[model samples]
Target: MLVFVTGGVRSGKSDFAERRAISLLKENGSNLHYIATNQVYDKEMQERVKRHQQTREKSGANWIVWEQPRKIDELFSHFKKDDVLLLDCVTTLVSNELFSGWETNSEKWKNVVFQFEIEQNLKCLFSQLAGAPWHVVIVSNEVSYDGFASDEGTKVYKRLLGRLHQHIVLLAKEAIMVECGLPCWKKGGIRT
Candidate 1:
Protein backbone atom coordinates (compact mmCIF):
# COMPACT_ATOMS: atom_id res chain seq x y z
CA MET A 1 0.00 0.00 0.00
CA LEU A 2 1.25 3.49 -0.85
CA VAL A 3 0.14 6.42 1.29
CA PHE A 4 0.81 10.09 0.61
CA VAL A 5 1.02 12.78 3.30
CA THR A 6 1.73 16.47 2.80
CA GLY A 7 1.63 19.69 4.78
CA GLY A 8 3.42 22.94 5.43
CA VAL A 9 6.45 23.17 7.68
CA ARG A 10 5.84 22.16 11.34
CA SER A 11 2.33 21.05 10.39
CA GLY A 12 2.78 17.59 11.99
CA LYS A 13 2.73 15.60 8.74
CA SER A 14 5.82 13.68 9.72
CA ASP A 15 4.41 12.77 13.11
CA PHE A 16 1.21 11.57 11.52
CA ALA A 17 3.06 9.49 8.99
CA GLU A 18 5.26 7.99 11.67
CA ARG A 19 2.26 6.95 13.70
CA ARG A 20 0.66 5.39 10.65
CA ALA A 21 3.82 3.48 9.88
CA ILE A 22 4.10 2.19 13.43
CA SER A 23 0.47 1.14 13.39
CA LEU A 24 0.96 -0.73 10.17
CA LEU A 25 4.05 -2.37 11.53
CA LYS A 26 2.29 -3.51 14.69
CA GLU A 27 -0.76 -4.74 12.82
CA ASN A 28 1.22 -6.82 10.37
CA GLY A 29 4.12 -7.82 12.66
CA SER A 30 6.48 -6.26 10.17
CA ASN A 31 9.72 -4.37 10.38
CA LEU A 32 9.58 -0.58 10.68
CA HIS A 33 11.92 1.32 8.40
CA TYR A 34 12.54 5.03 8.19
CA ILE A 35 14.12 6.44 5.07
CA ALA A 36 15.22 9.91 6.11
CA THR A 37 15.83 12.11 3.10
CA ASN A 38 16.97 15.20 4.91
CA GLN A 39 20.65 16.07 4.62
CA VAL A 40 21.58 17.93 7.80
CA TYR A 41 23.85 20.81 6.83
CA ASP A 42 23.60 23.12 9.82
CA LYS A 43 22.65 23.39 13.46
CA GLU A 44 18.93 23.90 12.82
CA MET A 45 18.69 20.90 10.54
CA GLN A 46 20.75 18.85 12.95
CA GLU A 47 18.39 19.67 15.79
CA ARG A 48 15.37 18.81 13.64
CA VAL A 49 16.89 15.44 12.80
CA LYS A 50 17.68 14.86 16.47
CA ARG A 51 14.08 15.57 17.45
CA HIS A 52 12.74 13.09 14.92
CA GLN A 53 15.15 10.48 16.18
CA GLN A 54 14.05 11.09 19.74
CA THR A 55 10.40 10.76 18.78
CA ARG A 56 10.96 7.42 17.06
CA GLU A 57 13.00 6.19 20.00
CA LYS A 58 10.21 7.09 22.37
CA SER A 59 7.68 5.25 20.20
CA GLY A 60 9.18 1.91 21.31
CA ALA A 61 9.43 0.65 17.74
CA ASN A 62 12.74 -0.62 16.47
CA TRP A 63 13.07 1.54 13.39
CA ILE A 64 15.81 0.78 10.96
CA VAL A 65 16.90 4.19 9.75
CA TRP A 66 18.41 4.77 6.33
CA GLU A 67 19.86 8.20 5.74
CA GLN A 68 19.30 8.25 2.02
CA PRO A 69 19.13 11.73 0.50
CA ARG A 70 19.26 10.50 -3.08
CA LYS A 71 18.96 7.33 -5.16
CA ILE A 72 16.24 5.85 -2.99
CA ASP A 73 15.83 2.85 -5.28
CA GLU A 74 19.15 1.53 -4.09
CA LEU A 75 17.51 0.48 -0.82
CA PHE A 76 14.84 -1.67 -2.46
CA SER A 77 16.82 -4.87 -1.95
CA HIS A 78 16.97 -4.23 1.77
CA PHE A 79 13.23 -4.21 2.34
CA LYS A 80 11.11 -7.30 2.79
CA LYS A 81 7.52 -8.33 2.21
CA ASP A 82 4.91 -6.61 4.40
CA ASP A 83 7.42 -4.26 5.98
CA VAL A 84 6.35 -0.69 6.71
CA LEU A 85 8.58 2.02 5.26
CA LEU A 86 8.16 5.71 5.83
CA LEU A 87 9.98 8.20 3.63
CA ASP A 88 10.19 11.32 5.78
CA CYS A 89 9.92 13.87 2.98
CA VAL A 90 10.31 14.20 -0.78
CA THR A 91 11.13 17.91 -0.93
CA THR A 92 14.66 17.40 0.30
CA LEU A 93 15.15 14.36 -1.90
CA VAL A 94 14.20 16.32 -5.00
CA SER A 95 16.41 19.23 -4.04
CA ASN A 96 19.34 16.95 -3.37
CA GLU A 97 18.90 15.09 -6.62
CA LEU A 98 18.28 18.22 -8.69
CA PHE A 99 21.20 20.30 -7.46
CA SER A 100 23.74 17.54 -7.01
CA GLY A 101 25.80 18.59 -10.01
CA TRP A 102 24.52 21.98 -11.05
CA GLU A 103 24.87 25.31 -9.33
CA THR A 104 21.78 27.42 -8.68
CA ASN A 105 22.91 30.10 -11.19
CA SER A 106 23.82 27.60 -13.92
CA GLU A 107 21.80 27.64 -17.13
CA LYS A 108 20.96 23.98 -16.47
CA TRP A 109 18.34 25.08 -13.98
CA LYS A 110 16.23 26.16 -16.95
CA ASN A 111 16.66 22.85 -18.72
CA VAL A 112 13.78 20.41 -18.64
CA VAL A 113 16.14 17.46 -18.63
CA PHE A 114 16.84 17.76 -14.93
CA GLN A 115 13.15 17.77 -14.08
CA PHE A 116 12.47 14.84 -16.38
CA GLU A 117 15.29 12.85 -14.81
CA ILE A 118 13.96 13.44 -11.31
CA GLU A 119 10.44 12.47 -12.36
CA GLN A 120 11.74 9.30 -13.94
CA ASN A 121 13.80 8.37 -10.90
CA LEU A 122 10.85 8.86 -8.55
CA LYS A 123 8.56 6.96 -10.87
CA CYS A 124 10.95 4.05 -10.93
CA LEU A 125 11.20 4.03 -7.15
CA PHE A 126 7.46 4.17 -6.66
CA SER A 127 6.87 1.47 -9.24
CA GLN A 128 9.22 -0.82 -7.40
CA LEU A 129 7.53 -0.12 -4.08
CA ALA A 130 4.10 -0.79 -5.55
CA GLY A 131 5.24 -4.07 -7.04
CA ALA A 132 6.55 -5.24 -3.70
CA PRO A 133 4.39 -6.40 -0.82
CA TRP A 134 5.60 -3.65 1.52
CA HIS A 135 3.53 -0.76 2.81
CA VAL A 136 4.99 2.67 1.92
CA VAL A 137 4.16 6.07 3.32
CA ILE A 138 5.54 9.09 1.47
CA VAL A 139 5.68 12.51 3.11
CA SER A 140 6.18 15.82 1.32
CA ASN A 141 5.77 19.54 1.89
CA GLU A 142 2.98 21.62 0.36
CA VAL A 143 4.98 24.57 -0.88
CA SER A 144 2.72 26.00 -3.56
CA TYR A 145 1.16 28.45 -1.12
CA ASP A 146 4.53 29.82 -0.04
CA GLY A 147 4.59 33.36 -1.41
CA PHE A 148 6.09 33.52 -4.83
CA ALA A 149 9.85 33.71 -5.07
CA SER A 150 10.94 35.59 -8.17
CA ASP A 151 14.09 33.55 -8.71
CA GLU A 152 14.21 31.15 -11.63
CA GLY A 153 15.64 28.31 -9.53
CA THR A 154 12.92 28.65 -6.92
CA LYS A 155 10.31 28.64 -9.66
CA VAL A 156 11.66 25.46 -11.17
CA TYR A 157 11.87 23.75 -7.76
CA LYS A 158 8.29 24.61 -6.93
CA ARG A 159 7.05 23.43 -10.33
CA LEU A 160 8.87 20.12 -10.02
CA LEU A 161 7.64 19.59 -6.45
CA GLY A 162 4.06 20.32 -7.45
CA ARG A 163 4.22 17.84 -10.27
CA LEU A 164 5.77 15.19 -8.02
CA HIS A 165 3.09 15.68 -5.34
CA GLN A 166 0.34 15.24 -7.91
CA HIS A 167 1.90 12.08 -9.26
CA ILE A 168 2.40 10.64 -5.77
CA VAL A 169 -1.14 11.36 -4.66
CA LEU A 170 -2.48 9.72 -7.77
CA LEU A 171 -0.54 6.54 -6.99
CA ALA A 172 -1.28 6.55 -3.29
CA LYS A 173 -4.05 4.48 -1.75
CA GLU A 174 -4.56 7.22 0.86
CA ALA A 175 -3.82 10.93 0.54
CA ILE A 176 -3.85 13.28 3.51
CA MET A 177 -3.09 16.92 4.17
CA VAL A 178 -2.15 17.99 7.69
CA GLU A 179 -3.11 21.48 8.85
CA CYS A 180 -2.49 22.72 12.39
CA GLY A 181 -1.80 19.12 13.44
CA LEU A 182 -5.13 17.95 12.06
CA PRO A 183 -5.26 15.39 9.27
CA CYS A 184 -7.68 16.12 6.47
CA TRP A 185 -8.22 13.12 4.29
CA LYS A 186 -8.18 13.87 0.59
CA LYS A 187 -8.42 10.23 -0.56
CA GLY A 188 -9.36 6.90 0.99
CA GLY A 189 -11.00 6.36 4.36
CA ILE A 190 -9.61 7.07 7.80
CA ARG A 191 -8.41 3.59 8.55
CA THR A 192 -8.69 2.61 12.18
Candidate 2:
Protein backbone atom coordinates (compact mmCIF):
# COMPACT_ATOMS: atom_id res chain seq x y z
CA MET A 1 0.00 0.00 0.00
CA LEU A 2 1.10 3.56 -0.69
CA VAL A 3 -0.04 6.32 1.68
CA PHE A 4 0.56 10.03 1.14
CA VAL A 5 0.31 12.48 4.04
CA THR A 6 0.74 16.21 3.51
CA GLY A 7 0.23 19.39 5.53
CA GLY A 8 1.54 22.85 6.31
CA VAL A 9 4.76 23.55 8.19
CA ARG A 10 4.69 22.26 11.80
CA SER A 11 1.12 21.11 11.42
CA GLY A 12 1.83 17.77 13.12
CA LYS A 13 2.28 15.93 9.83
CA SER A 14 5.56 14.25 10.66
CA ASP A 15 4.40 13.25 14.12
CA PHE A 16 1.24 11.81 12.65
CA ALA A 17 3.20 9.92 10.01
CA GLU A 18 5.52 8.49 12.66
CA ARG A 19 2.65 7.37 14.84
CA ARG A 20 0.93 5.80 11.86
CA ALA A 21 4.08 3.87 11.06
CA ILE A 22 4.23 2.52 14.58
CA SER A 23 0.59 1.53 14.50
CA LEU A 24 1.03 -0.19 11.16
CA LEU A 25 4.03 -2.08 12.49
CA LYS A 26 2.12 -3.20 15.55
CA GLU A 27 -0.79 -4.27 13.41
CA ASN A 28 1.29 -6.21 10.89
CA GLY A 29 4.65 -6.89 12.46
CA SER A 30 6.41 -5.02 9.69
CA ASN A 31 9.93 -3.77 10.14
CA LEU A 32 9.84 0.02 10.34
CA HIS A 33 12.12 2.12 8.13
CA TYR A 34 12.44 5.92 7.87
CA ILE A 35 14.07 7.89 5.05
CA ALA A 36 15.03 11.45 5.96
CA THR A 37 15.79 13.62 2.95
CA ASN A 38 16.72 16.89 4.63
CA GLN A 39 20.37 17.89 4.96
CA VAL A 40 21.46 20.11 7.84
CA TYR A 41 23.26 23.03 6.25
CA ASP A 42 22.69 25.44 9.13
CA LYS A 43 22.21 25.53 12.89
CA GLU A 44 18.45 25.86 12.68
CA MET A 45 18.18 22.85 10.40
CA GLN A 46 20.49 20.92 12.67
CA GLU A 47 18.21 21.72 15.63
CA ARG A 48 15.14 20.61 13.70
CA VAL A 49 16.84 17.38 12.73
CA LYS A 50 17.85 16.77 16.30
CA ARG A 51 14.29 17.32 17.49
CA HIS A 52 12.94 14.85 14.96
CA GLN A 53 15.44 12.26 16.08
CA GLN A 54 14.54 12.87 19.68
CA THR A 55 10.84 12.62 18.95
CA ARG A 56 11.34 9.31 17.23
CA GLU A 57 13.38 8.07 20.14
CA LYS A 58 10.82 9.24 22.68
CA SER A 59 8.15 7.36 20.79
CA GLY A 60 10.25 4.23 21.37
CA ALA A 61 9.76 3.06 17.83
CA ASN A 62 12.55 1.11 16.22
CA TRP A 63 12.98 3.16 13.08
CA ILE A 64 15.85 2.23 10.82
CA VAL A 65 16.69 5.70 9.55
CA TRP A 66 18.41 6.49 6.27
CA GLU A 67 19.48 9.99 5.18
CA GLN A 68 19.48 10.50 1.44
CA PRO A 69 19.17 14.13 0.30
CA ARG A 70 19.14 13.25 -3.39
CA LYS A 71 19.04 10.24 -5.71
CA ILE A 72 15.73 9.27 -4.12
CA ASP A 73 15.16 6.51 -6.66
CA GLU A 74 18.07 4.54 -5.26
CA LEU A 75 16.21 4.25 -1.96
CA PHE A 76 14.01 1.41 -3.20
CA SER A 77 16.94 -0.99 -3.23
CA HIS A 78 16.82 -1.12 0.55
CA PHE A 79 13.19 -2.24 0.79
CA LYS A 80 12.23 -5.66 2.02
CA LYS A 81 9.13 -7.85 1.81
CA ASP A 82 7.84 -7.13 5.31
CA ASP A 83 9.28 -3.67 5.69
CA VAL A 84 7.36 -0.38 5.86
CA LEU A 85 9.17 2.47 4.14
CA LEU A 86 8.27 5.87 5.60
CA LEU A 87 9.69 8.68 3.49
CA ASP A 88 9.33 11.80 5.59
CA CYS A 89 9.02 15.08 3.70
CA VAL A 90 9.02 14.72 -0.09
CA THR A 91 9.05 18.51 -0.32
CA THR A 92 12.62 18.68 0.86
CA LEU A 93 13.63 15.92 -1.52
CA VAL A 94 12.16 17.77 -4.49
CA SER A 95 13.80 21.01 -3.40
CA ASN A 96 17.15 19.30 -3.22
CA GLU A 97 16.66 17.91 -6.71
CA LEU A 98 15.64 21.27 -8.10
CA PHE A 99 18.42 23.27 -6.45
CA SER A 100 20.98 20.60 -7.29
CA GLY A 101 19.91 20.70 -10.96
CA TRP A 102 17.71 17.68 -11.51
CA GLU A 103 14.34 19.15 -12.56
CA THR A 104 13.61 20.09 -16.15
CA ASN A 105 11.29 22.92 -17.19
CA SER A 106 11.22 25.37 -20.10
CA GLU A 107 11.61 28.54 -18.05
CA LYS A 108 14.62 30.26 -19.64
CA TRP A 109 15.56 32.27 -16.57
CA LYS A 110 15.37 29.17 -14.37
CA ASN A 111 18.92 27.85 -14.67
CA VAL A 112 19.15 25.60 -11.68
CA VAL A 113 17.63 22.57 -13.37
CA PHE A 114 17.33 21.36 -16.94
CA GLN A 115 14.35 19.36 -18.17
CA PHE A 116 16.13 17.17 -20.69
CA GLU A 117 16.99 14.33 -18.31
CA ILE A 118 14.42 13.99 -15.51
CA GLU A 119 11.66 12.09 -17.32
CA GLN A 120 13.36 8.71 -17.18
CA ASN A 121 14.42 9.43 -13.64
CA LEU A 122 10.86 10.13 -12.50
CA LYS A 123 9.61 7.12 -14.40
CA CYS A 124 12.11 4.84 -12.72
CA LEU A 125 11.25 6.27 -9.32
CA PHE A 126 7.52 5.73 -9.70
CA SER A 127 8.09 2.28 -11.10
CA GLN A 128 10.23 1.37 -8.15
CA LEU A 129 7.65 2.61 -5.69
CA ALA A 130 4.87 0.69 -7.42
CA GLY A 131 6.92 -2.46 -7.58
CA ALA A 132 8.07 -2.44 -3.99
CA PRO A 133 7.06 -5.60 -2.12
CA TRP A 134 6.01 -3.83 1.06
CA HIS A 135 3.87 -0.92 2.17
CA VAL A 136 5.02 2.72 1.85
CA VAL A 137 4.11 6.00 3.52
CA ILE A 138 5.15 9.37 2.09
CA VAL A 139 5.07 12.66 4.02
CA SER A 140 5.09 16.02 2.26
CA ASN A 141 4.26 19.66 2.90
CA GLU A 142 1.34 21.58 1.36
CA VAL A 143 2.77 24.57 -0.52
CA SER A 144 -0.29 26.02 -2.21
CA TYR A 145 -2.27 27.19 0.80
CA ASP A 146 -0.65 30.63 1.21
CA GLY A 147 -1.05 33.64 -1.01
CA PHE A 148 0.67 33.99 -4.35
CA ALA A 149 4.45 33.84 -4.28
CA SER A 150 6.22 37.20 -4.68
CA ASP A 151 9.20 35.89 -6.67
CA GLU A 152 9.70 33.84 -9.82
CA GLY A 153 11.76 31.16 -8.13
CA THR A 154 9.22 30.66 -5.34
CA LYS A 155 6.45 30.45 -7.89
CA VAL A 156 8.31 27.85 -9.89
CA TYR A 157 9.08 25.85 -6.78
CA LYS A 158 5.46 25.91 -5.63
CA ARG A 159 4.25 24.80 -9.05
CA LEU A 160 6.74 21.98 -9.12
CA LEU A 161 5.64 20.70 -5.72
CA GLY A 162 1.97 20.94 -6.64
CA ARG A 163 2.54 18.92 -9.79
CA LEU A 164 4.64 16.34 -8.00
CA HIS A 165 2.03 15.87 -5.26
CA GLN A 166 -0.68 15.39 -7.83
CA HIS A 167 1.25 12.63 -9.55
CA ILE A 168 2.04 10.90 -6.27
CA VAL A 169 -1.59 10.92 -5.11
CA LEU A 170 -2.60 9.23 -8.33
CA LEU A 171 -0.26 6.36 -7.58
CA ALA A 172 -1.07 6.17 -3.91
CA LYS A 173 -3.83 4.13 -2.32
CA GLU A 174 -4.52 6.80 0.29
CA ALA A 175 -4.13 10.59 0.39
CA ILE A 176 -4.57 12.81 3.44
CA MET A 177 -4.22 16.48 4.29
CA VAL A 178 -3.26 17.46 7.83
CA GLU A 179 -4.19 20.78 9.39
CA CYS A 180 -3.76 21.91 12.97
CA GLY A 181 -3.03 18.36 14.16
CA LEU A 182 -6.09 16.94 12.45
CA PRO A 183 -6.22 14.91 9.24
CA CYS A 184 -8.66 15.28 6.42
CA TRP A 185 -8.73 12.19 4.30
CA LYS A 186 -8.84 13.24 0.67
CA LYS A 187 -8.84 9.66 -0.61
CA GLY A 188 -9.36 6.25 0.92
CA GLY A 189 -10.51 5.46 4.47
CA ILE A 190 -8.83 6.26 7.77
CA ARG A 191 -8.23 2.59 8.61
CA THR A 192 -6.43 1.77 5.42
Best candidate, TM-score: 1
TM-score of 2: 0.87
Candidate 2, residue 99: lDDT? 63
Over the stretch 76-155, how does candidate 2's per-residue lDDT look in tens digits? 66777868888888888777766663345435427544522443355456557756777778899988878799998687
Q: What's the TM-score of every candidate structure? A: 0.93, 0.87
Task: Report, for every candidate in turn, its global Cα lDDT versus the true structure.
Answer: 0.87, 0.79
Q: Tens-digit lDDT track for model 1 on 1-192?
A: 988989999999999999989887888837889999998889999999999999999999999999999999889889888999999889998888777765445555466886787778877777777667999999999888799979988888898888888888878889999998999899995742
- Deviation from native of the Cα of residue 49 in model 1, angstroms: 0.3
RMSD (CA, Å), each prediction: 2.0, 3.6
Clash pairs (backbone) in predicted model 2: 104-114, 104-115
Among residues 3 or more apart in sequence or in different chains, the pairs in candidate 1 whose N, CA or C atoms overlap within 3 Å are none
